[model samples]
Target chain A: NAGVTQTPKFRILKIGQSMTLQCTQDMNHNYMYWYRQDPGMGLKLIYYSVGAGITDKGEVPNGYNVSRSTTEDFPLRLELAAPSQTSVYFCASSYLDSSYEQYFGPGTRLTVT
Target chain B: GIQVEQSPPDLILQEGANSTLRCNFSDSVNNLQWFHQNPWGQLINLFYIPSGTKQNGRLSATTVATERYSLLYISSSQTTDSGVYFCAVVSSGGSNYKLTFGKGTLLTVNP
Candidate 1:
């Protein structure tokens, strides 16, 4: 299986610009998540989906939105990019079971200028 | 919100040396995992151990759920093992799908 995959390995956005980060998983996982990691810091959850049509805000969801239209896809939308939003973004997926061992994607590095 | 803390934020070890990384959580957790982020920026899941002990090759992990702490052991470390190690957990009382991550322990193994 392809596990989890993300698009646009790197991106540079201007202030107020908007973009969507794509994430897909072929593991048939019922749970998907978006997280951002700053340099030298741990990752912070941005958004997550329990299943198709079920999405929820995570720890740092202020500047982001997400949608789970299909079990295979969960996309994160940035309405207005800012310098603070510049970070390495990661997408992960896991089975919806007692053991939520998540598998992560390669990550997208974004820089807001 | 649950708090997760990892110790020895930085470590430098010689090749073939052994090292241990620790993760401590502020609350009870239903899920705990260790991930190794290589220099190339790929997060590889090392262990999905919420409790008890598990080992794979030169790496091993032990979690004491009751104590809310976990340990990751790397024996005979190699330069390839140089990277950031992260520990994440899901609070038993919080959303099962959300994981709180620790700052991570950065290990540098020199040949």
Candidate 2:
């Protein structure tokens, strides 16, 4: 069902480089999220959107930006990639029902040198 | 910021063994979920239990909001169950959909 899809499975960027991580969900869920997983660390929220045209920052939103212009797409933008931003990024979507279960993408592994 | 703690950072179990993973949060949450991230980095949802118990096949979960703790039980564990188990909670306020995750429990199953 291609529940959630993230583009650029892998990327290596030099410091100051910029790139966008694309995420799309076919479930038409209202909630979408961006998280980064460091080595041996759990997922940390970078940003999240409750619905289209509404977005907010999360715990570790310092090096990233996000926009939710449509229900099917929520993209994370890295304006000036830094070494600290190197990590595996995961995109997820949820229906916000009683279960509150989130479906995640395969993930994007990024390394900033 | 809400704190999440997962017990037994590392676990080793033989095939067919049973195990329980624990997660304790610093505050009450509107959402709590368990996920299994395999070696390949694919995250699979195991449960979305804010409270009460729910089971799916050989896996089950229980979240006690009042006690600020949750337990995930894995029965008859197989090699496929070897991965990182994560517990995440979404606190009240505008961050309801944003999850705060624990360090995770890494399970290694020996067949």
Report the number of the highest-lDDT candidate.
1
Q: Which ten residues in a row have the lowest lDDT in candidate 1 chain B?
A: B90-99
Would candidate 1 be rated incorrect, acceptable, medium or high by CAPRI criteria?
Answer: medium
TM-score of each: 0.98, 0.94
Quote model 2's TM-score: 0.94
Q: Show model 2 residue runs off by greater than 4 Å.
A: A96-99, B93-96
**Best candidate (score: TM-score):** 1
Model 2 interface CAPRI class: medium
Which residue segments of model 1 deviate by more than 4 Å?
A: none
Candidate 1: tens digits of C-alpha lDDT, residues A1-113: 88899999999999999999999999999999999999999898888889999988888899898989899999999999999999999999999898888899999999999
lDDT of 2 by residue, A1-113 (tens): 77899999999999999999999999989999999999999998889998999998887899788999999999999999999999999999999675557889999999999
Query: B1-111, model 1: which lDDT tens digit per residue?
Result: 889999989999999999999999999888899999999888999999999999999999999999899999999999999999999998988964788999999999999
| Residue range B1-111, candidate 2, lDDT tens digits | 889999999999999999999999998788899999999999999998999999999999999999999999999999999999999988764345678899999999999
TM-score of 1: 0.98
Colliding residue pairs in candidate 2: none
**Which 10 residues in a row give candidate 2 chain B its minimum summed lDDT?**
B90-99
lDDT score at residue A61, model 2, on the 0-100 scale? 93
